[model samples]
Target: MTLGNFSRVTEFILLGLSDTRELQILFFAFFFLAYAMVLLGNLLIIVTVKADPKLSSPMHFLLCNLSFIDICCTSVTSPRMLVDLLSQRKTIAFEDCIAQLFFLHFVGATEMFLLTVMAYDRYTAICKPLRYTVIMSRQVCWVLVFACWAGGFLHSIVQTLLTIQLPFCGPNAIDNYFCDVPPVIRLACMDVHVTEWLMVSNSGLISLVCFLVLVTSYTFILVTVRVRFTEGHWKALSTCASHLMVVTLFFIPCIFIYLRPFSSFSSDKHICVIYTVFCPVMNPLIYTLRNNEVKASMWKLWQRYVEGRKRTVTFPGDTDHCILPAINSLLQYTSVIISTMKDKMHKVNTSTVSEFILIGLSDAPEVRFFLFVLFLIIYLVTMASNITVFVAISTDTRLHNPMYFFLGNLSLLDILCPTITVPKMLEVLLSENNVISFSGCILQLFFLVDVVGTEILLLTVMAYDRYVAICQPLQYVNIVSMKLCARLAIGTWVVGFFNSLLHTSLIFTLFFCASNEVEKYYCDIAPVLALSCLPTYSRELVILTVAGVLGSSAFVVTLVSYVYILLAILCMNSAESRHKAFSTCSSHLTVVCLFYGTTICTYVRPSSAYSPDQDRIVSMLYGILTPLLNPIIYSLRNKEVKCALGRVISQVRTTLTK
Candidate 1:
């Protein structure tokens, strides 16, 4: 029962799909394309689903969730596998495998549950059309989503609990691509036959249940469709067909692998390719190509984009809607798309961040000096941007208001966000071998959690700000005053800090640091927490509680705020003023909708249906795009800001002419 009784294995040898060099190269090429597909497809789905009103139903909601799941599920295996294939070494540490096992199952099980719910939803809609609205109302739908997630957590807890308890003091090589129950259980030195049988019911049975539910539901629905078949009814089938096809592909592969006895499948590597890599790649493509609504929406968006581009490229001599400003934003959009998951919401420094090496000579004079200079610049910029924004709002009389106050807090968070990441980054870069002390990595984990938590909290507050401004315009001053803003801002940071602290602390609690090299450049709490050598129910419990509280609370508050805002907007009488109000709110609404909607698509649901890369891009909307757009949006359309800019430009032009 105790980890103390078992000998501690430091690292693990990962037997990637094949040991052959030719196979490795071929696989790398194949997986690289798959990873790209996962990224592009998911982003396209998120953007298209968001842009279209017709695709804004609970059905598209499930699809968006699927896109996100496919993204993470692919990232879990493919990118790492691709890197491993290229390198001479193909090994994953014992600790890393455990982490992978947890997430792999967590996301996988979550998706299974989500698919079952989607099937049920379709069955209810098609089979019981009269009662569909009452049964699948917005509240009921969200509840079902909540229940799906709850089921995922409960299932994942059982599997992780079983796996982590096994004493793995034997052969370190994992036979297949990544960690799974069969491969991992095979590595255990202790008798796992009982656990294996339990898994038959656990992994195999759970999947079978979901599959049967899907099969039965689809059969009845298809029969229902046949009964009501008409010439015009063909189009209706397309929407559900895409989902059904993708679901079949996803579930069949899953059932083939999981539902069967572990020995029944010769290699999980080939199976891994199907579920983790191919399913995700296929999902976005299948959904987008098959769904007419998404295609129409994407077409409109493309037309707008191309026409906008044409206005710039074709008309060099003419100033169309201030072409210079559009030109200026060109680089900004490009940079945002390329940035990392953490840097998703903010404008990141464009300089290449080299991998940190921790060779002994890193302590030498030249190395230390270079590191100080390198990290100092990064640290200085990170601190300055956040501090300046914070001070601009906090101290300046002009900015002594709720809007600026929230912005100041965000800046402060941005400051902390990079602080958590870049310190160890510089430390590793300075060190010749890129080693981080256990204490230091844990420290970085703390910073990562706290800063991210702060940002999420701040965004929720910002949503409230918009609600007040648009909905309760007259009493905006009274409601979101200086004091209230300060309290909310403070509370937000405090909640995030404490939450992050719990997870970071858990990493050090059961953990004896085995691997210093993190797959990610910066330390993240989830990945770090994943490295635990002990039973993971405790860690997952903390994750469930924290993620549930933060993710749900933020989403609910923001969603409720918009509902009120919509109600108030509808009640207003002034047509011109209404148009003006809608215009002003449109940009903010668009940004907010993109932020929380994408987040909920992944996090608010259980881990099942969210994609890692989709999570990356969607999160990036807040992380990279929002920060860049915040300054742009606040400055561009505001008459005061535009006037200020015009004044500065006119003064420069006048002086030049003179």
Candidate 2:
């Protein structure tokens, strides 16, 4: 069918679980907490399984994959559902609905097949102990995982193709939180009886076959255990119990929903929540609480972290007692600043504007397309490299020192900085829809300021770390205790939050009646302030004052630390020692120069000096290019990071080939 004949509806309204305001609020809180738990629990499992040498078995490997799938599956629907529960309109665009349907089934079916494979794994380990290793070797495990993913892809493509080609000329209300095969197929313009049955057979038969196989595998394993009646048998049975519980929770909901025609039964939406929301939340809890090995590994990891925190060094005449008072005074001053800003905002005149137009990078179509592709590649590489560094530092205990800890924070900031701006820029480039609501503009500026401010403080702290490591080598461990590191990290974030809040509150309080066109692709302080009708002298003065104090202080500290570091390096008798010392700081110094150079050029100048074209290029250097280069700089220059990354890569390779 042509585009005109495909569908008349541009979007679909979702009637979520309830219409009552009280019920919606309650459900929102419930699901928000549940989603947070699902993410944290599954991530902990993945990290623990990777970090601990004790969890190198094939069973644990499969469990790690299962945890990853749980995260992917829940993320597909939970975020959208949570947003809808809070939203009044609760609508999804036509293309978004179809994409959701595709990934929902793709990851869902993949999990089902993986669970069945885990069942088979258990059966071999228990019933065929003599040949278990031979049968379920590393190569065989890789093949099984590959097969599961391939099967899931095939299954999802068939469903998506069938549903996408159907004509939905009108009536685009879906009576559930998300898009799915049955509910979506029911909305077709033509009769869907044949399509419904075909989809049902496709989904239902797979669930049934997997369910039956799991059942038979468990049954045989149980019988074998009863006959053998050994200590090893008892342990295997305990492991099987966790898997069985997960299997029961997951498959029962799949069978109940798919093994029928498309109908709007009252229980349909509720049952969908079981496999979609409940299963992912419960999987980690079931495995960790029931399986001894996982529990032990988690406990060890926690103990190590706690022990590191507790090993604080004490020195004679130390002023540690004064630290708490200083922090308390700082917090009190911040509260006063916030209150003063609120009062000032209330006194200012409010504007009538609701949205602003963003004049993107270029007007030509080809230029826009080129920018889109360029930024898209940058965004992907930034995310991949930063996530690799973050995960490497997290999962490898060797990289647990203060330097890597700060580097991990830097990686996280790199991830957040680009994520705050790039996706919207990509959308604007692709669709030429450059209008942003007032609230979105405020949020974008707020988070951008927060990440940048946090990075400033974090870099200063990292420089201090290097100074201590180089200048006070004997006292490095005692001075940079994990507790102090944690406190410093928290302090940076807290200060950054207040700093961003103060600037955002101050800027938005001014009336914005002059113009609605933002000169840059994304919202920033200079552009937004330039659009204000009222005199921005007070805001500008405040920005200058704060930037001077904070920026100068951080720069002085970093500069002084590096100066001392250079002196210490030059004084070293061994050339080899000097080279090693400087190598450790090179990556951070390069990043510092890139970040501060672009930031100072853009923000330190008066608003009257702002050139739109020049400002955009400068902003991209700090906002986009810096994040893309940070991890590459660290990975290439830092030997320990390289080794940790190598170990992570080799572990994955070994898993696939051993």
Candidate 3:
């Protein structure tokens, strides 16, 4: 067991699928397309599930997870394999080989457990239809998904630990294109009999068990459908058919490869390719083609995207020609900034940071639990209230005016804004695993800024809508047309997108060679910038200059509109008219104050005055409380919204009963 006994191989040569130059190129081309399809197909599934309200069931949620895992599973090996296919030397470092093996089994085993879970979900839905919702409730679904991931981790860790510990002093060329248990273990410089058996039991046994469970579940489903010959039974059987196909394709290959000694078979590479490359590519296609709901959602999503593109391209008047050039210039500017920052980082070698540790809200155990529960509840309520508001606006024609349209957009933001931060905050509070990868932190910060920026502009737009309604009631119809509303909404989102891109690029371009601890619950611009090793004065200045110009412009527009609105309200002769007008603007005004007040306090001050604890609390005010409060404020104050919500609820009830 001692490493001093022999030389350890530092890398492994992969013979790969084919040795011919033409064959390698052909393999590369084929796999590149397969990988692209896997990514695009699975991404579409995820986006469709998230966007379509009708697909908000537990089943679709699990499908979304499956799609994501497929993407991850393929990405672990496919990219490297594709590269090696084109390279002269098909070799991977020992550490990278081990890492690749770790993630391969990690996602692979997770998919096994997930497929089994999906089978159980189908079983419950088909066999126990009466208790389906209760059995597969949102909480239960989350737990099941978490359990699948944990189980995968445990399985993969055992395999990895056993493999990494063995002495690999010679025969380091693996027969397959990727590192795997059988091929890698065969190269170890010791007797791997016991180790191979352990791996077979760990991996092969698990696959066999999951496969058997799925078979049993589907057998029962088929029997139930055969015995009761009903339309519902037939429909359930059709759904299970897709899961059955996926299980067969995924598990059979896994069992074939893992259920024996570490002996090389000529067919091993082919079988490995089936599960690793083909299964991931096919799962999304099978699901989308077989499942009507997913197909419908995808079609709707595509239509929405197409409509949005048309709206973006086709402006009202001669504005299209003017706007196209501005958009192109903005895109060019973004590209220049990104390329410039990347070059600077490369020259200075300042991009050495790998990950960040967030010093979350509180470290005390007692307070951590309290904060977790508090934020969890807040997040759930935020999602429910915002989703309800969005559904109401979409379904109820009575609430489809420009005011409700903007409100619907706000509700969507409320859902998105908290979602970006609160889940991570809760995880930090509960598990204390506050480390986020560098790319992850940048992404979180980018989205957080984008949503916040959009909300600021949206609030200003909402104020203008009110001003048109109250101050210029006669011109409101002509001024606040749907086309104009669409343009304004689109503009806010585009501006937010560019604004976030600029700030995120600028902040990350700085040297982060010092501490990588973000001193807040989640990644934010200020906390992340605070950790930079280089001077952040220029970045801070840019943030301030942009925020000041944008924020002040929005604030001034809102203020002037409100000033005119107030004058119009006060000039009303009837008290009833005044009350109606005030009620219409009250909810928006309250949200505006909450949003602007907290954001200004957090971002406008000098860095020397920044306190982590104080900033955390202030961030929660806008980040957490504002989203939670928007729906409640609007729903409680506006009778029309309340009525729309009631109608939505009744419609849902009706649908469920049917």
The Cα local distance difference test for each model comes to 0.66, 0.87, 0.86
- The C-alpha stretches of model 2 lying farther than 4 A from their native spots are 1-5, 307-323, 334-658
RMSD versus native structure for model 1: 18.8
Query: Comparing 1 and 3 by TM-score, which wins?
Result: 3
- Summed over model 1, clashes come to 32
List candidate 3 segments past 4 Å from native. 1-344
Candidate 1 per-residue lDDT over residues 5-52, each given as its tens digit: 374666677788887654554455456655876888798888788777
lDDT tens string, model 3, 1-658?
A: 2343243788899889988654564466567767877898899999999999999899899999999999999999898898787567898988889899999999999999999999999988888889999999999999999999999999999999888888888788898888988888888888888888898888767877887888788887878777777888788888888988998899888877787776644538978888888998889878986788997788788878978998887654666666678789878987887777668657764567889999987779999999899889999999999999999999899998999999999999999999998888888888889999987887898899999999999999999999989987898988799868877988998999988887787877777877888888889878887787777655665576577667766886798689778978999999999999999999999999999999988865445456898898999999999999999999999999999999989988999999
Candidate number achieving the greatest TM-score relative to the actual structure:
2
The candidates, ranked best first by TM-score, are 2, 3, 1
lDDT of 2 by residue, 569-615 (tens): 99999999999999999988999999999987787655656799999
Write the number of the candidate with greater TM-score, choosing between 2 and 3. Answer: 2
Residue 411 CA displacement from its true place in model 3, Å: 0.8
